[model samples]
Target: MSEQTGKQMSKEEKDARFEAELLPVLDPLYNFAYRLTLDEDDANDLVQETYLKAYRFFDYFEQGTNAKAWLFRILKNSFINEFRKKSKQPAKVDYSEVEGYYNTEDVEGESGVATTTDMRTESVQDLIGDEVASALNALPVDFRTVIILCDLEGFTYEEMAKILDIPIGTVRSRLHRARNSLKEKLEKYAKSMGYNGE
Candidate 1:
């Protein structure tokens, strides 16, 4: 049956369909929202708003299409249109001074001696997850959103492009830049914590 026919379903049927199809996407949506807002309260608000919009427009959803992508698109649009508008902050900081840090050569002496410790030697990922999260939080909202959607949330580049209403090329480039930016931030944090470049 076509999606339009499905939309004419009874309330119970609609609810059943929604639960079966859409509910599974909630956790990912929540994670995406949390990363975007970086505040529990704001994340809750965004998720709630996303659901409301989704529920209201559920009939328009074409069955067999990617429900998660559809929901993400709604949530992203809501964020940009509503939440993003209210926050008139700059998207990027003046990190020019820190730019050189990223350009620094790998941990090798001029004589080609390996000076840096191997990152795999220390299982500090768990210890640093929170710090990495904080660094992600400190990033510009746009970059943070892309990172969470692509990395943490595990959305494909195409899915993210659909969600963000951007071209696939833009999605790839943004994800690359965001990851690089995140790595730079985490490296700074690691240094501060005396991680010895490991």
Candidate 2:
């Protein structure tokens, strides 16, 4: 095998390589961990444990591959294996719930006559970014993870799939649902703040 593609690295090499690549990813990984754990202390511990595991298994990583995805995969797995058990959180409410709620509401037809009160006069887009961030924090863990990774962190669907160990279709669907959920939550928050378009 070529030197670059050869068998696993020595202990020193592994430590060096992991330090070089994995350290820089700590902030992004911490952001993801915080989104999952929703606590600063837990996020720090989770990231530290993830780095330790990644360092121990550094040889398994292939050279010249997407290190970010590889590191993210390690972080995600560590979160699932360790933190998920203690959390006991339920998955986010599905799309059917949202659809059912909407369907139950009576609205105007194409004629545009009077109908049920449209209390949704305010758009969430008007909320400041920090308020949006807080609203994001209020989301369920599942939706928050997807939004942080895909929307805030700018990871592509394929990378997210690899990181989360799910199919790309699942990533896309979760992202769609997560964004809708965030929008709804942000709108509600903005309305609560008395943001009636001004």
Candidate 3:
């Protein structure tokens, strides 16, 4: 839009560009949000808030940059702000989870559907994926986040550093410790599946 930039985009052009560049990252962004909050509703809210803030401050976003990283940074900040606010209040339980537990009858009952474990012989990958997800989720938020950003999302150390607003060294340290923690968590599952520590 600036004359000096040699490219002038109208409002419609900007909107189109924004959608073209940013929309594709929505799912990954939502995945990151879910991993952070561990709640579908919270993740949706976080993603919505991220888009709103990104759109509001679109002018500050430098074009041709890593839009995903930018959106992640915004989402991380929002999650932190929300976390702080929630921490101040008394903890609230999700009654629906309790109610569902009580109401459900033999969750794996008469329905002939096979669960991840049940189909392990046919798809070891699916079972391992579930184990990995469970192990990953067991990690503290900071550790889980580093693993998600680095290993899962495939962000480089530098990009993760920027997204997390930490030094590259800290990112590396955190990721290293996070991986060790995850490995420890998954070791039992791995051994059970015939993967000895050797």
Which candidate ranks first by lDDT, i.e. highest? 3
RMSD of each: 7.2, 8.6, 6.7
Where does candidate 2 clash, by residue pair? none
TM-score of every candidate = 0.73, 0.71, 0.78
What total of clashing residue pairs does each candidate reach? 0, 0, 0
| Native-to-model Cα distance after best TM-score fit, residue 47 in candidate 1, in Å | 1.0
1 against 2, candidate with superior lDDT: 1
The most accurate candidate by TM-score is 3
Superposition error at 15 for model 2 (Å): 1.9
- What do the candidate models score in CA lDDT, each in turn? 0.75, 0.71, 0.80
Worst 10 residues of 2 by lDDT: 107-116
| lDDT (10s digit) by residue, model 1, range 46-91 | 8889988887787888888999989888888888899877655676
Clashing pairs in 1: none
Please report, as a residue range, the 10-residue window in candidate 3 with the lowest summed lDDT.
Answer: 103-112
Model 1 regions more than 4 Å off: 1-7, 86-126, 193-198
Which portions of model 2 show Cα errors greater than 4 Å?
1-6, 87-127, 192-198
**Candidate 2: tens digits of C-alpha lDDT, residues 47-97:** 888888877677677767887778778878888887767656566344445
